[model samples]
Target: MTFQWDAIWGALPVLLEGAKLTLWISILGLLGGVVIGLVAGFARAYGGFFSNRLALVFIELIRGTPIMVQVMFIYFALPLMVPVRIDPFGAAVVTIMINSGAYIAEITRGAVLSINRGFREAGLALGLSGRDTLRYVIAPLAFRRMIPALGNQWIVSIKDTSLFIVIGVAELTRQGQEVIAGNFRAMEVWTAVAVIYLIITLALSYTLRRIEGRLKIL
Candidate 1:
């Protein structure tokens, strides 16, 4: 089939609307995920026996399962079991947050554990509480160290928004499908969608590298 270049331009507006939601879901999810990861990571690193074990179980359960299944359970199954009903957008964002938190926790934990014990000892020697030592010293260093892993997860989280289409969140991929259905221009619509995603990812990669470089200088 002959491809029409203009058809891509025609689809941009529709796709951008969908992409907005994609960004919304990704940003909110990542924000929440970072908080969860940091807290859980700290627990695993220093919360002692039971807290560490609990964090490990939560992370493992999330990482081991498919994200789609998780979203489905939250959106469909949970309502059946409890007085809860999350719309597709809420479900999608929550799913990404949960999924991203698991991986981010592992990344945070690894970064924290890799730090020299002497640093913590020094902070303690300075009359600082363990919490203060972590907050004022180790946490900052570990976050800087984990920049690459967090950036990687940021991209993964963005791309994963496409999966929310299965639950009818009307994200980028779903928008493309709707356009294709109306026009029957599968190649053009899908190609445009793919290009849009590539652009977003590339822009994100560039921004992340800039942040990473800035952190390295600090």
Candidate 2:
């Protein structure tokens, strides 16, 4: 069968809208993931026994599960157990935050631990309190090391947004499915959808590369 150029052209607007929502939710979710990762990472790295154990359980539980199951549980199961009912969009964002946070926490822990112990000791000797030393000395250096792993997680989280089609979030994959449903142009719609994802991920990779270069200089 001849490829349907017209179907792709016609579906561009809807696909772009879906792509926008994908990017939006990814950014929001990964931002929150970064915050969650930082706390969990530090707890695992430096906190006392209970805090470390708690963070370990959280990280392990999240990392052990599939994101689809997590989102499904949030959207469909949680309402049965609690006074909370998250809509599809909210569920998608929450799941990405949690799923990515687990991985990011591991990345953060590795980066922080890779730094020499002497730097930390030196900071303490210079009259910096433990909190101040962590903030002013350790965090900046570890963050530099985190750039690549964090970039990877960001890209993974963005692609993971497509899975939200299972929950009907109208993200890029769902838009492609809808377009194909209306026009019976699965080949064209799916090709357009894939190219859009490639464009976004490639652009993200390029931007992260530039940022990594600049950070290396500092």
Candidate 3:
């Protein structure tokens, strides 16, 4: 009963700004993640032994750790390890990119490997080079199958932006926190924030599902 509707309204515009920033970060982060996933997935699929091992190690190491720890390391500990300190936004994007990449790499590898070997053999039998075989035969089918998994990872990446607030980036959750801290209307602020996230996530899910359905191997 203590919820103040007026406070929620007053905070709406700034929270919307925060939401836009969150979306920007998530999109850019996932784009980077997709590139990394594709490269690492290919390396695992067709690279020489050393390259394959390296790719596998990268995927495993990222997957094994909590993302919060990874983000903190990149933001706080990276300066000690390297010459430059990463800003909060950069750290958040890097965290999302790498974290999303690891999972997507695993998904990509699975999708690639799950394809029947006959398709690959047939491509080779047709005088296609190894590269051509992958491009024409393996990659097309594998990526088509990868849509759903990629969409799920995209959702995770979007949610992960909330964690960046720990480093002081004013994402949607952070903005909501600031509102509550100022107005002492935790219920109203948090409820508004939760609904905003839910709306976007549900919309993303719907869109992805439509794409998935259209792209299904039928």
lDDT of 2 by residue, 69-127 (tens): 99989999999999988989999999989998888888889989998999899999999
Query: What would you estimate as the lDDT of candidate 1?
Result: 0.91
Superposed model 2: Cα runs more than 4 Å off: none
RMSD after Cα superposition, model 3: 1.2
List model 1 lDDT by residue over 26-58, tens digit each: 999999999889878888988989989999998
Among these predictions, the greatest TM-score belongs to 2
> Per-residue CA lDDT of candidate 3, range 64-164, in tens?
99999999999999999899989999999999999998888888889999899999999999999989999999999999999999988888888889988
In the order shown, the candidates' Cα RMSDs to the true structure are 1.2, 1.1, 1.2
Estimated TM-score for each candidate:
0.97, 0.98, 0.95
Model 3 misplacement above 4 A: none
Q: Global lDDT for candidate 3?
A: 0.91
Deviation of model 1 at 212, angstroms: 0.6
Pairs that clash in candidate 2: none
Worst 10 residues of 1 by lDDT: 209-218
